[model samples]
Target: METSSVLIINLLVWFLLLANVLSFSTFEKLVLPPSVTGPESASFDRGGEGPYVTVADGRILKWKGPSVGFVDFAYTSPNRTKIACDGTNDLKFGPICGRPLALSFNYKTSDLYITDAFFGLLVVGFNGGLATQLSGGYKYLSGIDVESYTGNVYMTDASLTSDSTGRLLKYDPRTQRVTVLLSGLSGGGGPAVSSSRNYVLVPDYINKKIQRYWLQGPKKETTEVFLTDCGSPKTIKRAVNDGEFWVAVEKQVQQQPVLTEPQGLRVNGSAVVLQTVPLTQFSDMTLAVVQESNDALYVGSSYTDFVGVYKN
Candidate 1:
């Protein structure tokens, strides 16, 4: 009887552990049409009426409803024609079709700023159509974020060569001036400013680290590694909580063939991880952006034909 009781207790303990491991919310796929692929990043408007996404085919699409699906919001290049650009992911046509990667909104002006993999940075007003080119002359513009209070844009240039020739830049909408904040970043991912607007967290994808750059306060203009050993973080977005952020990470597992596991982590301003959410259900896709709105998490991928929503 004593042995049987001990066996039952151990079985219960293992059951609880398994339950904890499966505690994550199940992700429901938000499927896009065949023409739309690679919704790399998602942003919502001031009115809370969108999960507007930038697709690989060079268009920013707005989600209207389940029936209407995503409608055309904006295009990066004015020369982009449907015949030449739609439903394609060829890098050679990137210069003409304009592969948009990251997106953020300026709430004050109701304008959206985007980083094109080929076109550098661009913006469009509330009534979207053709986005105006704000800055260019960069090899690859990977990520972007807008300061809601000042309308200034922070962005990252991933690389010039195969090495770590990346750079972090700031673009002033008022003056139209572009300033380089930092260079020598190893595959810079994305920038997410703090709630106080005093610091920005930038991810180094190649180095598997996140760096914090102070924009204000006593540590102004200083940069430091916020977190290390992060598995190829892609986009860092401000969390719903103050002084916290959500980072999307892609973990590569090498066996005979390589496998990828995606995850989302919540970290505080002091570089402490608060929570980690596994996104392995979308492992086949490159989860580039994980954004939080209300109590739900929105996941975007640059290689999948769907976005994912996981609600807690």
Candidate 2:
């Protein structure tokens, strides 16, 4: 009887191992959709700079996705070709681009400011960029913005489940100081600095509203609903010249696309409708133009895993 029991246990172990092998093999075969249609959120109304919105399959990160932080896009100057996404690798300082996060460029300083989900606010140069560690000991530093004039850096600490708390912070590059700007966001994600350089545009995840706040005191500011019922508004950016902006929304909760959030939407032509478009599969954040220009619109997504070139 003891021998019989032992034999049964051995068989069970073998069966379980077999099942796991089969499951892993099946998972490997699962492929994502190649292309997507128009926005599912609203009617087709359009939109940016150098790169025309052409679906480039090259942007997909085969190994990264929902687990990542902000997926931002940046184009090199002059011709504005060759886009860059953050946190796609592992490096000590300037190597912040490969880690699954967001990035913005300070064209004045020739520096790239990055929001690292794991590392906090950082700055690096292009290709051989100089990386600076701006913050540490925060739950998650998800979004980043820079003052084009003063080079003051503002970032979001999206620490939804932490005791220290989530807050928007200001960092002075000249003095190397960091200060908390605001706290009590449900989950702070995307942040766009107004072209006038006085206020900021943010998607308050918990509140489910797009908010505009003053750079100082914020008490004299007005908060209006730019768009309602957006899934988890991830990143926000206002055009440098045109007063237009973009937002990336996310809905899924599973094997998640790289963008996991949504692609993005375009705002233009003096419409109060504030129409929002969905970039299917592309999730997380859409770090867009510092200022709108004659160049084509360039957007990067984690789901689609490629930078989209849209002609304005």
Local lDDT at 281 for model 2 = 28
Which predicted model would earn the best lDDT?
1
Single out the weakest 10-residue window by summed lDDT for candidate 2: 36-45
Tell me the TM-score of model 1: 0.89
How well is each residue in 151-186 modelled by candidate 1, as lDDT tens digits? 889999976455788888999978999999988788
lDDT tens string, model 2, 1-312?
999999999999898666533321211111222342111111001221122211122111121233542222332111112234222222232222223255555657656676654446666554422345666667667677677788988777876553435576788988988987667666757577766676776767656556666765554454444565655566676653456676655644556343344534545323232444443324344332222233433344433333443432
lDDT of model 1, residue 100: 90
Q: Estimate the overall C-alpha local distance difference test score of candidate 2.
A: 0.48
Clashing pairs in 1: none
